[model samples]
Target: MKATILVAEDDRNLRRVLRAMLVREGYDVAEAPDGEAASAWLAERRADALITDIRMPKMDGLALFRHVRERHPDVPVIFITAYGTIGDAVEAIRSGAFDYISKPFDEAELLRVVGNAVRTSAVSVREGAGGEETGGWFGMVGCSPAWREIRKVIEKAAASPLSVMIMGETGTGKELVARAIHGISRRGKGPFIKINGAAIPPALWEAEVFGYEKGAFTGAVTSKPGRFELADEGTFFLDEIGDVPLSMQAKLLRVLQDRAFERVGGVKTLTADVRFICASNRDLRKETGKGRFREDLYYRVNGIPVHLPSLRARREDILPLADYFLARSCAEMGIAGRKLSRETAEILERYPWPGNIRELENAVGRAVALSEGEEITPPDLCIALADTEEEEATPEEMRFHESVRDHKRAIILRAIRKSGGSKTKAAEMLGLQPTYLSRLIRILKVEG
Candidate 1:
């Protein structure tokens, strides 16, 4: 794709000349008369490169550059100033400015300066500080193949402002995925607002997500900005989206479809110009088939369904992730870094991480807090694991007579839970048939 550039200058003639010259060179160019306009422009769309004059009314290039750096520090910036203000340009250079081109310079020189600045900026972005290759977002902190695939999908999804649904068991870092996508997307400069769709009551869902005008409903004392409005020009993350009532799902679908919504008791339609990223632990497809969720809405939200692999599927990453969190936990406590003994690492690998990555982080955190030494041993982790018996299960102890019955019964139970109590889904989750599942459930005396 051709590079898109933005020119921020107060002079109208300069803006016109720059636009004409850049367009002739086959570059997409946007013009802003001042930093205020430039900020608004950036808030709407992302640019490959930004060129601004240092001084302006309302807001200056330094302030705009600072904001851009804070939001998207990777975006290249070029500042133009007269020779007299070269000192200010020098300051900009120290603050991560792309490059500075003195005023009254040739058009060719300016073009080369901007082009080179953009190229260099992209290179530095990929090779982050300390000359290390940047992988995914900062919080992901895993080099596992499973994590790598998750990162690749998030990067691709962030390019567009489409809605994304991430489904995983609880404590799988669903929110981290949402934040990573938003942080890398064009809307990185916009606000990022998150809300849990499960905790709020059905009566408050509308007011919470779509806001409300004064006196819209009882206890609606004044106007309030909802999560959708607050996230305009940015990303809105809805956690536990499957928990939303079927009635509210229709409203969500309308806003997603039209990119617009209206506050309660308000006639005029307001636009929700933002990216929607929803996550849930429930099987939304099964929910729709069972008449508990809207079919259309399910299709809408699951446009790009990303299923995060459970921790057990990628057991190779357990030890490395545990060590990473162990170091972090020690630093947080102002204690010496803790090393996980090889024995401890082996134990961690054997325990099925039913709670996934979140559980691992917590396990390490608790170990660090409870242990007083620099080395975390197997005893430390074992004590931590024993506190939670959610993974408790017995071996296939039923000999000859009951062995067949016990194994089949366990499979049936797992499938039913995974399928949200639907016979068809249970069959699908376990790779069985509806008839087989029905027979097993009857024989096993399964309870819904």
Candidate 2:
């Protein structure tokens, strides 16, 4: 069946053109002269996607977008705007519009955005009512006691409109918890904008968060909405919050307190009704005490504190998470599903995953790619299982030096095998000099 597209524009000629363009692409086209008529049409029927002009008679695209968000959350809305109103269109994107195109727009760009919207809408419908699968609890996959407690906190946090702070080690899924909070909240249908403090430079921090006018900087050719503005009536995730510069913390705090900020170079004050979800590997309280982070900002953003335990702490979740990753990897790689051998499963459960869930997922993906048999073995995982045994051994049962040598040998052998027995490639994989690897290979008596 052809996907249906609804075009809402006040200009009769432009609406007709849009209809023709959509029809040419083999899509069923519906036309509305203005937002009011579009809303009326939607009250009785459904369209796979919506395309509307930012400015329309009787009602505007923003109003229509809000209505669609509330009534038909699955349908993606695309905005058409003049160059002068690009900021408005960008704001709509922050408020959950799928995409936008400027006037004098290329027909190809419009069709491309429309095609994406239609496909995304169809996928959302197929996924279920909430438009996303929540795995077990809002897309988190775990049944451990720690996870159950975290779920309670997430449910309570989502019920309120307060800011959230998720604290965890680097790969313990802090961002996943932040997303779960947003997905289950009242702002679930709204945009979930995120920024990594560590990734953005200190020089561009202000403009990146608060936006700027076209002439604000050397490369600023056009006005752009910041993450906060885009996140209006939604959730804004601040990843690696501890990495935010001290100079910017006060500005962030002010926004959180007053919900108002001006563009970097412009004086017009903009306010966003956003719920902030912050995550950090560092403890903000310690940073505040060390004067590296502002105490006031810490207090403001840390309205609710939730901590995710490292994978090792929640050992029972390891096998389950590995299996989940295995199935997902198989599907993504377009390969037949494979199961973990009994020894491999035991090794995975016993391994202390220092890098946590993210590392485990990578390992599973690698195993899926490398495993040629119906079952993944310990060797296919490319992990030093000897280290796990060494850690579990009592001092009386095994000599520390012997265990260390064995662990090193196991790791070197695995790397060599994974590199197709090339010492140069194995050295690169092990982050060792080729001469060093050769020396170790001789000392450890590891032979192909």
Candidate 3:
């Protein structure tokens, strides 16, 4: 069956043109002269996608898009706007609109975005009722094969009694993985305590991981149960284990082996009934080989290694992750959830996320707070785009014998193409000022 596209525009000429174009592309077209008409049409039936002007008679695209997201989340909505309403359109995109096309947009571009919206709508059919499959496995989200395989590994590892080590880059949700293991294990009902090895001072690691005696030091006025004691008969997560000092590693190793420790400045030995789950962005084996980490400690915490793929390595999860972040941020900030445009999604997927999921979450939160309208646009996510431009290199540029000049020129060309020939947008995408992009275009003799 041909996908049905509803076009809601007050401008008769633009509506007719869009209908004619969609029809030529073999789509069944529905026309709405205003937001009111579009809402009325939606009341009776559904279209695969919606394209509405930001400003329409009786109602507006922003309101209509919100209505659709609430009532028919699977039906993607796109906005049509003039230059004056670009900001409003962007806000709509962040709020949940599928995408938007500016006035005088290329017919090809329109068709491309509409096609994406239609494809997204079909994909939603498989996403169940929540617009995502967040299986009942500890708040973990993503439908990628890597994520699925990781879930299986987590379940198997959780069922075991051996200590587990989670390895991944910073912001790769290692802590979440640890919590998931704890939540699924037999000790799920017990306390799940965590300590950041990197955050605690080397001198205080002992006192923090083990109980401290009263008057242990000048500031020790009272005895306190350490992280391990707090997590007795439960799970203890040591994050950034690679950052733990060599001296502390020996003490930690002793506790893991003996399952006992003495309070600081006290002779009474205490046994801890705790499960260990260690995490680190660094390679523990390499650290041990370098004589910076204890070999014995490394082996003790690495009984089962669970490595998480970075966001860049699992590009398929980017959009779902973004949506998850947006929803969470919106809820936390008391704002409505936003959606990503296909164009924005493409940019996110193309970018190499060096900082991983943590970075993505921060970026989404920033976008949500800064976005003035319903949807998030490219500008709203420019901080991440800037980071991507600085650290990421394209395949063509990474090849041997690729000259510096050629790489620079290629970057400029790609940015321009990605920005649809808008120098300002291209500059933003490239993390360069508009004047710099123009200068480079002139110097490279590239057609702008």
lDDT of 3 by residue, 1-448 (tens): 5788989999999989999999999999999998889988987666999999988878888888877866676688888878788768655553446566767676765776687667657634421122312333565678899999899999999999999999988777787788789878999888676666765667767876785786787545445556676777789888778888888888899889978998898898899888999988888899988999888888899999999998888889888888887887787568976887776777788878777876676667767755667878765665334322334666875552234345456556666787788888776554455786677778657764
Between the candidate structures 1 and 2, which one is better when assessed by TM-score? 2
lDDT of 2 at 168: 87
- Give candidate 2's whole-model lDDT: 0.79
Which stretches of model 3 miss by more than 4 angstroms?
Answer: 1-136, 387-448
At residue 346, candidate 1 shows an lDDT of 80
Taking all chains together, each candidate's TM-score versus the true structure is 0.57, 0.65, 0.58
Model 1 TM-score is 0.57
* lDDT (tens digit, per residue) of candidate 2 on 1-448: 5788999999999988999889999999999989999999988667999999988889899999988876676688889989878878786777667777777776765776687677667644432123223255554578789878888998999998888999887777776677788888989988887666775668778877888786786645556677788898889988788888888998999999999999878989999999999988898899999999998898898899998888888888888888888887798578998999998898798788877876787678767766678998876674322244445667765775575566567777777898898888787555455887788888779876
lDDT of every predicted structure (CA atoms): 0.72, 0.79, 0.75
lDDT of 1 by residue, 335-364 (tens): 888898887888789888777776787678
C-alpha lDDT (0 to 100) for residue 310 of candidate 1: 82
| Shift of residue 51 alpha carbon in model 2, Å | 23
After TM-score superposition, the amount by which residue 74's alpha carbon in candidate 2 deviates from its true location, in angstroms, is 23
Q: Please give the ranking of all candidate structures by TM-score, highest first, separated by commas.
A: 2, 3, 1
